[model samples]
Target: GADVVHAHGLHAAARTALALSGRSVPLVMTWHTRRYAEGARRQILHLLERRAVRAAAVVLAPSSDLVDRARLRGARDARLAPAAAPSPRSSQAPHEGKVRAELGAVERPLLVAVGSLVPHHGFGTLLDAARVWRALDPVPLVVVAGEGRDRSALQQRIRDEELPVRLVGSRDDAGELIAAADLAVLPSRWEGRSLLAQEALRLGVPLVATEVGGVPELVGEAAELVPFGNGEALARAVVRLLGDPERCAWLAEAGREQAAGWPTEDDTIAHVLSVYDELAQPSPHPR
Candidate 1:
């Protein structure tokens, strides 16, 4: 007999399992994020979310905000266990000079962002901030590396505005680029413990990210947090960090320290096992 069912998201497969089994076994559902494109699809997912939350034996959330959302949906047991990261490849520091050279021949302050070129990822806001930053004495080069359906539209905007932003399509060495950046910016509208945030902090890259979803939880004062969707705020934060070298160094050092304390893959596995153990215990009988 199966001991438990673990559902990652409110996808069709998870919905099917919930429908077919009706909570026959202990069910653990991890709510990464509730973000979805608005429409009939979003409505359907919200309904599924309610059903899944009610049926789950325990809901694991990466941040407390999501735990609250789960409880609102009628989840009886919701726990916070921030996502784990793979072990670092080596303790050696990243070579900033080499990585910077790889970015481009242009010698300008490099700001790197990596994510799908989608509306929710909020590349539009970043582009606007780039436009605003162009007046700086030494203009920065905003390099974005990713691919999505919004590629064509974003490209057109870049051309129309004549912004100092480059959409370099997709990149494999995104981590290297991030390590080389004068600043790592994530102006996402919504997020749930992003891997990019983790990578930036781990590499000791000074970060300026939007305060949305679990981003604050990940950065935890180690990086500058800006309000989401405000291009002016994003631009100001980036400009301030670039001008203050000492502040940037402090943020980078603090980021590395924060990243050091993150849970490892083994720790995540152990937490999952403990949850299973709790579920497997037999209940006491009443007389």
Candidate 2:
């Protein structure tokens, strides 16, 4: 155990570090996710994170965006680490028809976009694109989970657009829904790297998402990228996935392969411990 300790995110890894630090153990700090692009409120948050960041033995970042933000907030030396991706806790095999049935989606083709209803998550863009898809062939069902202050407005947008969508806000069973989906998407304007996308890829759902932040870093060949806020392009990709069953199946399988090879929950624990180890290690050149 390190003389000082720190951790990031809400997972057990962060909690463990906090618990150890409570015994007067020195724990460093890490910030894995932040609100969004900088503005007045963001600057205020940056100020707060900056204050917290300076006390850490070493700051850790799970995505380049977060790394950059931490650096911007004065965490210049925060170590960079890929976000630890945990596989589905139980059986989550995706059957063609059965999985769709569970989600109340018909057996045509399903394109799921998972994220908060917030502006940063791009749920509104997703709904707008889905409206375009309504006129396209083999229309998809967009199943979104997560809740925020924008939930009501997003709901109104859904009603206004008349999109084929299901808004399952703030759920624990989101993984099962991801498994049931044909594709998983994140339409966020900015992101630190979406945990939702990681989980979806782990379940091997085909990914149609935007190119931003660490998303491109993790999704690699598994996703079709579009510019952020280009509803037309995003809509086209969804339609493409929906129209082609063979391709959808292939993408789904490919996504699973990529996500399965990613770090496990235990791996997250190991990485976090390694950070603590570095903080505890003897410095070659010390004051």
Q: Write one digit per residue (lDDT tens) for candidate 2, span 150-238.
A: 88898887888787877877877677777677678889987665777787776667788889878887877887788899899998887
Residue pairs that clash (backbone atoms under 3 angstroms), model 1: none
Q: Point out the worst 10-residue segment of candidate 1 by lDDT.
A: 85-94
Off by over 4 Å in 1: 19-23, 90-95
Tell me, by TM-score, which candidate is best: 1
lDDT (tens digit, per residue) of candidate 1 on 215-274: 898789899999988999999999999899999999989999999999888888899899
Best by lDDT: 1
Query: Residue 159 CA error for candidate 2 (Å)?
Result: 1.8
Question: How high is each candidate's TM-score?
Answer: 0.92, 0.82
Rate residue 136 of model 1 by lDDT.
88
